[model samples]
Target: MQIAERMQGVSGSAIRELFKLLGDPAIISFGGGNPSKACFPKEVIREITDELLRDKADILLQYGATEGYMPLRRAYLDYILPGNGLHGELDNVLALTGSMQGLDLLCKAVINPGDVVLVEEPSFLGALQTFHVAQAKLVTVPIHTDGIHADELEEVVKKYHPVMFYCIPTFQNPSGYVTGAATRKRIAELAAEYNMLVIEDDPYASLRFTGEKVPTIKSFDTSDNVIVLTSFSKTISPGLRVALCFGNKDLIRKMTIAKQGSDTHSPNLNQAIVAEFINRGYMDKHIEFISGVYAKSANCMIEAMDKYFPEWVRYERPVGGLFIWCTLPEGWEADKLFRRAVERKVAFVPGEPFHTTPGAGKNTFRLNFSAEPEERIVEGIKRLGDLIREMKAEM
Candidate 1:
């Protein structure tokens, strides 16, 4: 019954566990960052999948290279990277079952137990878990509404001299904050200066509804210390489990070896489908359509919150990404609010799991706006607001 010491303090994803509560048909969930079902290009995917089965089944049904299905690596180079102001050859890319796998593989490839790994104070919970399981000594850098300051980040790097830094620079999870372009460039610089490898987990950059498209940290990685992980989950289909990462060739090779030990290889059929999806010029149009759908849902939720919630509860109107981070009044705990919400057939993620520092984020929680219908979003927010008022009255 001995679990490895690496997993001693690690726990399952709080969001994944929340799916258990979603079995009730009446519960309007805002817990997981689930892209709208409407966002999936079902017809296009069906058409592509059919063609792949008929034409490429021999290759796809067989074991794929641990490096990835070559076409996907190539498609990413041609279609995905250019928009981010990046370019990479095949050796620089690796296909992932999901972007989360990229983090795990990176950890396996590089981290030694107790090595310092820096993260945004409030980061993606899944990534945090991966680091914990890898036994990386987790450290935090503060991020604000404007994202982290380059000078401040440099000070932290100077302090810890970490093995790597993990961040979600654009439309960051839980908080929906975006690190600006100038700071991203500086981050690339800090990585080189300290020989720190920066893991840029950028699953939501393509989801921007407003604001200028900022450059990724990898774009400025002159010393090749930054790696960028991009996913089709938010843009195409999460179920497909297709994602890719571009980085230093040496690092990618190490990760590929690590990936082999884990999944052997990512599913070839899924990689081929996504590769064709990109090559056929379907990616951009699909992003536009889905972005519009999510934008409407986000606006509806915000409008409902404004009309229903008290002024003391604070959050920003997100320009993109699936979440709205809310902070309740000081000394109020959101896990308590979550309990009351579920009783009313509503749900959201309490913010504690997303934070690395002790006792941080007790007053905070995250609401995902991408999963529910517009009307359902309104009703959920109204019910949530009502519960907050009811809980306060009892207090």
Candidate 2:
């Protein structure tokens, strides 16, 4: 069979491929955006499994709804709503194999070929790829410490008049920067004014490690333009692949049709398990515990970089999240740095692939501390630092 050009333009995730090289036992990977296994409620899942089998052995094995299991959908509503001061009945929630699938459905449902989609310059690579595959023109908005630059976004809105603004508002991937509440309100206002859709991909919103909690843009959304996608992957278990999207009723209906043709909804058993997880009130308490672990792990990485990395390196002090963005001094290439670090038994993701434009972010990299043990984080940083020093000496 001949291949499609769109599929040709799409490539495997570079970070996922980089992770495969880590099959070598000598390597210490700071690359993958994975939570520490210690943080997962493994025992709780085992208990859920046992109870599910004992109570409803045959039903757990049966096929389920296209929207998802009703009990689990109801449970997800109860899990996310109270904190945001928003309440929704069963009509508002749609479960997915993962939030990533929700994003795919949204893209297919909303974006037509050549439709403009605004994204963060250094956004989540997966989102970038999804938009690219759908044949949408990817326009970038520069990200700020507080949020995306409002002035630049205004210009984009005026210029391209994009169909959607795809954003990871809380603890953004690659940058780990949280968009402030004022900015979130502004984004919503701009979307309403421009008649654009807002796809808020907030997988990490509930994982705040420090500072005051900020309300989601959806909480302030009166225009019904915002669609918020979140998941249990980071805070709970990634393996089960359960996630949800809450948005305007019309959009949800369209996406439900899109999903029905796609996978016929997310896994029923996984949804059932997650429902039990949330029903038991374990998700709330588990998130707090995960936050603590991430906070300490983040501190370990920052402390290690401060103590060991050269003064020329620049980086953000992430308020909350798994990774830190680091830019090596000018004259140091990130891919070369990755190669050198791997030689020394350490690894990190080169930053270029995360950007919408090519060649930019060549001097930068992202290090994930959430998955590795504290000692491994420190050691990996130390090794990466030494390699950079050695490279600098040669220059």
Instruction: List clash counts for every candidate, in order.
Output: 0, 0
Per residue, candidate 1 scores C-alpha lDDT tens digits across 89-125 of: 9999999999999999999999999999999989898
* lDDT scores in order: 0.91, 0.85
Model 2 lDDT tens row, 1-395 = 99876677788866568768778866888888888989989899999988998897788778777778887878767756777766787777788888889889999899998899999979998888889888899988988667777778889889999999999888889888888887788888988999899998888888787788888888878888998887889988889999888888888888999988998868777888899988988887898899988999999899999988988898877778788988877656898888777778898899889988777778888888888888888888888888888888888
Whose TM-score is greatest here?
A: 1
Shift in Å, residue 205, candidate 1: 0.5
Which 10 residues in a row give candidate 1 its minimum summed lDDT? 13-22
Give the C-alpha miss distance for residue 132 in model 2, angstroms.
1.1
* Error in Å for residue 177 of model 1: 0.6
